[model samples]
Target chain A: MNTLKDKATFKQAFIDTLPVMSGYLIMGAGFGMVMNSYGYPPYLSTLMAVCIYAGAMQYVGANLLFTGVSLFSVALTTFIVNARHIFYGLTMLEQYKKAGKEKPYLYFGLTDETYTLLSRPLSVKNKRAYRFYVTILNHSYWIAGCTLGALLGSAFPQVRGADFALTALFVVALVQSLEFHKRNDLPALIGAGATLLSLLIFGKDNFLLPAMGVIVALLLLLPEKEAKA
Target chain B: MTTHTYLAIAMIALVTALLRFLPALLFSRMERTPRFVIRLGQDLPKAALGMLVVYCLKDLDFTSLQGYLPATVACVLAVFSYATKKSSLFSVLLSTIAYMLIMNLFF
Candidate 1:
């Protein structure tokens, strides 16, 4: 009955999940409150959290929910927004395969936060169990937070500057990456330049696709030149 | 739920999962799946992080001080905070809090 029986493994995983758990709960609740504003009930928000499992996308989804957009747009937007996960999956192939039976769910649940944590690859005795527990724990926190947000949204409908946290998040990750691995500076500069150019050309609503396209193109086209030089 | 609701959920879920899995599935069997693709994966994070930060400020109005000052200040705060702690968590937390307070109080 208890496949997650190892007390030590569970404890370690829980400890690892603690910081993100609190963050997710708060963020999830913020999302839930937004959904509540959109006239969705708590159960539906919970369902979205459980099924969709992408925090930023769900926030965008809530915005799109009431806009009466076509289903095709929803799907397209979903892909564009979460396309970053594809890079995460590719980068994680070496480590994810090690998760064994947990690979499927690990693949399915690799949200931005989970991918960030796992990208560094924690040094744990039970890597498989740790990955699984971390994924599931993150999911649970999200679900719980969304549900709470929904329930409380009616009372607190406003969350100002909350979305800024996402940008701040990227900053934090970029800083950490730069600190630990200095080699990323070139790509970071390229990415920043391409994104700024694309944003100027594409506009906010349409910039992501072009930015990603530019990143891949630059990475593909520029590296050989540098290597030879 | 209506047909569209069900369809939306199924489509979004299916597309997202497939995307996340596509890379692994492509590379799982072959030891080498083009050096460029591997390098792209290696370098993508840094670029992606940069893009994401710009993406956040997409809505800010650079023409006006009120529109841009808070984020600018907070980013500086985050940079200084990261310089000291060298921890992403603290930098984000402090910068985000700084942004939130500034937004709530002034903007």
Candidate 2:
């Protein structure tokens, strides 16, 4: 039956989300450790992860929460900081349209990792089914990691420095992006330059938004040679 | 804990989810999206990522700069290694270990 096939496809999609889940576990655990160190209960941290599901933003939120920052300020910051998700959603419109009933879940599941996985030209029987499966699978992984971290926070008090893992992951992602594009350091240069300029001009707290704004503006305005496969 | 903290967390989560989920849900219903929306999507992710990288490195103090210097070197080394068609894992591992050693020695 069609329903049976859909179930099977969804199961496979979950299976395909394993890689992303692994990454999320490590990062989420790091977040848990940091939150515990800051005297927040692990359950709170886990809840934040489950609900917000934005990694860096959650980390930033934890700090802001500790300081008793206003909700308005946090909301404003998140909008400015994550404004890029708007673009991410835009790019996926065409792909997501063909997703049918699986569309809602696909939209919710589209994290950076999921996006990367979906964007790749991988083998799949049903692209929409696989996409939805991958998205749900990745979300489950993140939620699982967050819950595990919360439970482990108290018993294993001294969580080591795991923040570096995120940086390492990004470094790996940058390398992969480079390899994918066959480019010679342009992306890295732009990233570093924008970051440095933003830091100098905007201070630590506000640098990211303006820097990103500059980079996106520049990339959009400048014309590039068409990519050749 | 104050009620304000709890409320703040809830609000943050709500806003984030709305931004993330609404567009995908609403836009998919339409047969055709406007040109501006399409253009916005194309440019947004990279810009956001650029911002995130800056956000992470924003707290780099001069004193800690020395600690991160080796990481910078490792990044360059990794790029060259990648250029030579080496495995990405190998390049990242090599640089990470190098960074750790340098950090331990200096800091």
Candidate 3:
């Protein structure tokens, strides 16, 4: 009975993460379609979805790989692009510490969606289990979607205009994030401004890194008075 | 594409996994993290989000920021909708529709 109860809990946790899971599925499929169109085999794209698990970066990397960019440049770019994740893990320290043997996989599964879901408030009994489930479920959805797209690509002569789905997903994420943290529009405004400024200064090809750099620096330096709970 | 490319990808994956997993493992052993570290962690998401927002607008032609006037209007609508505590999905849908209409009609 105890084991059965645990199983039910895990199942529920997985179900709870379905919203984010579906989002990943759609985005991953978009990526897979793009990769297929790029002349890479479907299986390789599926493998990448499972292994690298960085959605947007993978899309960018695919273009770079196709262009035969240097491995060193790719590595450097990825490092800079994902540098913010280092700080994400810092916030999750306490929650992850309690994951015990499953800790490794928990860390491995920390994508943007997983991180967002895990950071939400939940009951004590469900917290750790939910985090684990969200991590696994998000990954599973992405991998499954990539595989499905690969298999379907052969049948569809051309899978065009799929990349726009990423833009839609980002819009959804931005709206959700804004909704979650009410009464504070500073971050959003700052991000929009910094991004526009950076784009103007650095140009399209080079804007992301500088925009992110400025945002991170400002966030680190900004002083905030503690909110009264 | 080549054997070397596969090897390089595998190496990147290995290093990424290590960087991602190591922090969770090491920090989980500690009973408490420093306050500054905790604060930093809390702020990271906001910073990351800022970066993503910038990424979304990176390709816009500011010289014709006028061309994207509808998107700008939609952004303002989204802000007001959010401030009023309206549903996020509704705000996104409405704004998107508005932007599309403006683009189709004007540009």
Q: For model 1, state the Cα shift of residue B98 in Å.
A: 2.4
Score candidate 3 by DockQ: 0.35
Task: State which candidate has the highest TM-score.
Answer: 1
Winner by DockQ: 1
Writing each residue's lDDT as its tens digit, candidate 3 over A1-229 gives 2122366668767655555555566667767777888888888888888898877677776776777777787777677656545655766776666565667777787776666556544543656666666677788888987777766764533323223233433454565555344335455556667777887898777776677667667766667635931
Give the worst 10-residue stretch by lDDT in candidate 2 chain A.
A157-166
lDDT of 1 at A118: 68
Candidate 3 lDDT tens digits, B5-49: 686567556656665765666655567776666655666555556
lDDT of 1 by residue, A1-229 (tens): 2254467877877765655675677788888988877787688788888888888788887777767579889889998988878877887777775556678889899887777666663667766777788789888988998998898775744557755665676677766667443454777777788889988997777777777787888777653424521
**Candidate 3 chain A: 10-residue stretch with minimal lDDT:** A157-166
Q: For residues B64-100, what per-residue lDDT tens digits would candidate 1 score against the true structure?
A: 8888999989888887898888766677778878888
True contacts kept of 1: 0.68
TM-score of each: 0.83, 0.73, 0.74
Candidate 2 ranges beyond 4 A from true positions:
A1-23, A37-41, A64-69, A116-126, A154-162, A179-195, A224-229, B1-3, B22-30, B36-62, B85-107
| Candidate-wise lDDT, in order | 0.76, 0.63, 0.64
Q: What residue runs in model 1 are displaced by over 4 Å at the alpha carbon?
A: A1-23, A63-70, A121-130, A156-159, A162-164, A179-183, A224-229, B31-33
Q: Say which prediction, candidate 2 or candidate 3, comes out ahead on DockQ.
A: 2
The best candidate by lDDT is 1
